[model samples]
Target: MMGLPFFRTPEIETPAEIEAASLRSDRFRLQRQVDWQRLDSIVTALENGRPRRISDEDLLDLPVLYRKTASGLAVARETSLDAATLAYLEALVQRAWFQVYGPRMGFTGWLRRFVGGGWSAAVRAIWLDICIALAVMAAGTLVGWLLVSREPDWFYALVPGGMAGGRTPGAGAAALRESLGTKPGSDGLSIFAASLFSNNTGVAIMAFALGFAFGVPTLLLLLYNMALLGAMLWVFADAGLGWEFAAWLSVHGTTELGAIMLAGAAGLHVGRTMAFPGDRSILAAMQAAGVRAAQVMAGCTIMLIVAGVLEGYVRQLVGDAAARAAIGTGMLLFWLGYFILSRPPRERET
Candidate 1:
């Protein structure tokens, strides 16, 4: 009765006939049409003790894809389906649904995917952001050095508020002491998560908002973020905190800085289009760039969440200087290897 082309051939009267139909049924389901009766029959075969076998048709079906029935069947046939497999399948369905029917990968994955595919993509985005940040940092460092060298008294004027007077070498120690004073309660996770979310949202908002003021505003914002970082580091250096501050920052700064840079890059991209609309209309260019920029910003948001989680839980756990240093260095390296060195697919074809 089903409209499926496969069904039109004729119904198999007995279970034996259907068992023989397994391979062809797959073809019918996948290349042809939805055959609910055939699907039911396949399920019945499984329930009755036949080894699971799915057709290419099953693979093509959205419901089957969502359920990961093919994967499940393969796993089940090869070996017993474990709890982990079941859990993974469930997660696949949920994620697939979210990706397809929902709002896409959001601010996080979208931004990350701008650079590459999957986690690797996020890593690439971070790398690009870092390179840009470093360029700014190096330029700032040169300027700071020249300024400090030329006019020692004017160092304080160059640095921003709150940090201008804070003793850096002592800030981490002081912050640590203050952090120690607080009870190691459940609130750490919440605080970290909140910070992560807020920081990411801040980046996204800055990236989008600065575009309205022409490109210069976005570039200034990036420079401003870098200045804050440089100032913070300068304080640490002046205070003789040495590697202690580095280690402390390693816990959260890596991810935070990465996100900020990403936001900056996104902002820069928007501003660039505005400043030099080349061939295309400015609005058209902005829209095109906006879509891509949004993807990168979304990725940055996810990075913020991940960094926040690490800072909240892992940072609290690692009180030792060595472990913190290792983690910080490791994170930096991991990011470097993943982004700068990644051999992505040729963009020309993709």
Candidate 2:
């Protein structure tokens, strides 16, 4: 009563049909019945948009089970069975077929999608938060710059000497100027730049990882990190090589600091979701915001690598203040243009 009735014959079964049906039914029920049932449930739920209820193990087994169901379906077609059994196998095969060979985005495809538009869309969505983060960093920089400029001793208090790499406020001008150029006999350029890059990466990681706690820690982190930058610059400038130091720093600062700022923005995004999760539950809002934040953070990480390489190779080769400024400024403008001005509009109308 349950299959292609137009092709079906009378209900009476021959002895051969009965024997074959018995063997096939027994084989399918024992070997594949449970998997088919599970597959049916998964396919049903997926079609309904409630896949979250599916367990990870079941999700993992979906394709495998789907393939197995297909094999069983092939077997079913070769064997005699009741109309009801044939109909059930046919339905299961169709569902499994959709899943096994359905449209899907593979890894390379996904990477292309992310690069093409995902990164830009994420950046645009959190532009306001990025502005706020930059403002905070600027405020902290100004405060630290002013503090060190007023009382040179504040540099020592604000920035660790180890991080200063002997570029203290009181260090001799000759000694300080030496830092403007690559060290005379140093193979430490790449190592040093990589170390600094790692340090910056750590700060960004901490800023993002700690953002779920209402973003207070993230705020403090941004303030402190930017303060260090300002204090370092002030110290170098006090030695009468402000422009030189600016040039040297700019070779990497635009990308490095920009990366940190984006991390701060990601942190703030999480914190805001925690504080004001509009209509959705806090967990739901956080989940959505986290995806956007991750996209921004990924781009930030790439920027940091670019910055580190420049610091190691490009900055090392160039020591003139003007040349350094030109390179650094050009890099900064490139980033601003790429992130803010270069991307195409989201959608086009024919």
Candidate 3:
């Protein structure tokens, strides 16, 4: 058949004989499993100017084979050839390559499934917690602000102990502004990690702490915290310190405030369960509420860490007003899109 020892036998046939043999083989086939798309791809490769044309010498690099059930013509063992198969063999190799790897990883199909599943799942929990808690907190804070403005001293006393550096409201506001607008703080990462842990723990404690009030105290505490945020923000804005407040607060504010509200909501849930005790016993209701609240707060803690990072590092590092605005807006959009636009895995029918 050939000079090469590997060319075990010669396959001599006229074009008419080859066609007739192909027809006979096709008649008894279990299925027409021809990989024609791969042939098309092989053609495309040639059209694109492959470095070298396939030649008889190229057959040495490829494994030559014959199938009894298929046509008795020689075929390449390798699915993809290295610019060296004869035109006919090149066609065969391309078809095999396409059949093996081509159908599985379609880019368009992959992207659709990815957006439907992975990305959506990653952010959905955080989004749900944010939406539900934020709306409630906003309302509570507004009411608290109205209540506290009439009695300023009482409101001041409600703030928890251990503020950073004992800075006055004015001084703290300035520092916060500086912190937000300046480059990354020296201990920004540490601050973020510490604040997130502490803040989340604070919410958990708040939920536990308010238990003493038979739940009213917890509601009051949350309302008080919200009022303080609203009033302080009002003060900052009135002093023409809007950007600084937004920058300083939003950096960690998103996570911290979000966590706080979740905690407060947890407390409120406990209180409501006890207050109503609809069909279930008071103890059972409280237990159920606690478990759900724990889930929500746990998610909130994660949000705090992310918020703290942005607040402590990214927010501070980006000094330009426009940059701060853009980042803040992006975060807000992310929160909104994740929660509102993205559907949960549970909602999707399997």
Predicted model with the maximum TM-score: 2
Ranking by lDDT: 2, 1, 3
Q: What is the lDDT of residue 139 in candidate 1?
A: 67
Spell out the clash pairs found in candidate 1.
26-55, 30-57, 107-298, 108-298, 108-299, 110-295, 111-295, 111-296, 111-299, 112-299
lDDT of 1: 0.55
Each candidate structure's count of clashing pairs: 10, 0, 0
Q: What lDDT score is found at residue 59 in candidate 3?
A: 24
Pairs that collide, model 2: none
Tell me the deviation in Å of residue 265 in model 1. 0.6
Error of 3 at 111 (Å): 23
lDDT of 3 by residue, 110-198 (tens): 55654554334433433443354457567766764555456544445544333332322444455545443454434422443354346
The segments of candidate 1 whose C-alpha lies over 4 angstroms from its true place after superposition are 1-133, 141-204, 340-350
lDDT at 241, model 2 = 78
lDDT of 1 by residue, 1-350 (tens): 11112112354589887666665445433542234334444444434545346565643464554444434434433433334443443444344454335663467664455556554553344354446555764665456545554554445665533434333333555543343222466342234334434644575468556865664565565555444445545555554554665676677667766666677666666777777779999989888767767766776776777787777677778866678889877877876676566555554661
Each prediction's whole-model lDDT (CA):
0.55, 0.79, 0.51
Structure candidate 3, residue pairs in collision: none
Compute the lDDT of residue 164 as modeled in candidate 3: 30
User: Comparing 1 and 2 by TM-score, which wins?
Assistant: 2
